[model samples]
Target: MTAAAPPRRTGPVRSEGVRLAILEATARQFAARGYDHLTIEGIAAEAAVGKQTIYRWWGSKSALVAECLVEGMLLPHRLAPPDTGDIRADLTAWVDAVLTLLAEPQGETLLRSIIAAAAENADIGRRIRESLAGSESIVGRLEASIGTAPNLTPGAPFEELSETLVGAIVLRALSRAPREPGDAARIVAAVLGPA
Candidate 1:
């Protein structure tokens, strides 16, 4: 052969590069195949990395899935709630944002996959809760704005309300049913009431 195959092109890849590659591959696979169907081997193959690389970084398929869900689906922490000082407007806008995300095909698929994964796997469920908590800047903002109004009674737990609203949107999206814009507004009104 000519010059020993050009010296083999060796040198270890950067850890960050490998991590990003694995994450990207996992996300694409999860979006295409859902959690139940995804495999570490498949992800490794898609990423062009060794199986050990993934295992070393994420520890398990469920862990990888959890990280993928957090990295891909959830909004950034910095955005938080609108805080217009009006709970109605804030809740309405939050609901609208959630609904809009759920309406997207990728977003809907991701939500269903994560929810299903969480239901079946306790580890995944815990990770999902943690991720949701971290991603719920809006909830914290809303709670802070509400303060200790005696009549309000702290309101229905914002986390529970968020789950319900998002769950409803996911169900509607998956069922291919028409989503009524008024429905989100109504839910916000019911949960937060008039300001």
Candidate 2:
């Protein structure tokens, strides 16, 4: 839960290949062993890089994970909301993807670990929130979809709707509760009204 020191700017320019390998290794290790058990040494050995290499770039396990999340290397496929021209369908598909991830043991563990790390570190928390809400993020996609809909509620709160849909799943994951089969459709309806 330590803050990431600015990456050494003066060192030999970082090798993109090595950086990617480290991220891949971090994801693999995180999936195989939950975050609590993941270590820089394990990642370094897996990626065939030295521990100092990871420390030099990422500074801490939480920081490394934050980078992985931002780079879309933490999950199997990037969780993008499909733009199928039908906002309801697209939103439902997106919510389903999130639920699919949370339904898995690894995904649940990863979310829990990230939440724990963010809770213990303000910088990590800020990075994650920024990434999740950024223009290229899921919320941004939701905003785009909502903007195109013809019959949205007058003055619909875009950010709130985006957060509510995703936040519901996050809350479910954090509470260790099973999501119902109709949860996705219901959430989409709640956010967008009957479609």
Index of the highest-TM-score prediction? 2
- Candidate 1 lDDT by residue in tens digits, 1-195: 555555554555548888888988887887677666789999999999999888766666766766676664334432245666766676677667767766776556556766666766677777655554543454565566555323234664767755655566566677866678586687666555544
In model 2, the Cα lDDT at residue 118 comes to: 76
Q: lDDT per prediction?
A: 0.65, 0.77
Cα misplacement distance, residue 85 of candidate 2 (Å): 1.2
Backbone clashes in model 2, listed as residue pairs: none
Query: Which residue pairs show collisions in model 1?
Result: none
TM-score of 2: 0.75
- By summed lDDT, the worst window of 10 consecutive residues in model 2 runs over 146-155
TM-score of 1: 0.61
**lDDT for each residue of candidate 2 in 1-195, tens digit (9 for 90 to 100):** 999888766776789999999999998888789777899999999999999889887757877876787677777363766766677887888888888887887677677767766776777777766776766566666566645555354466666777777788788778877777888888888777776
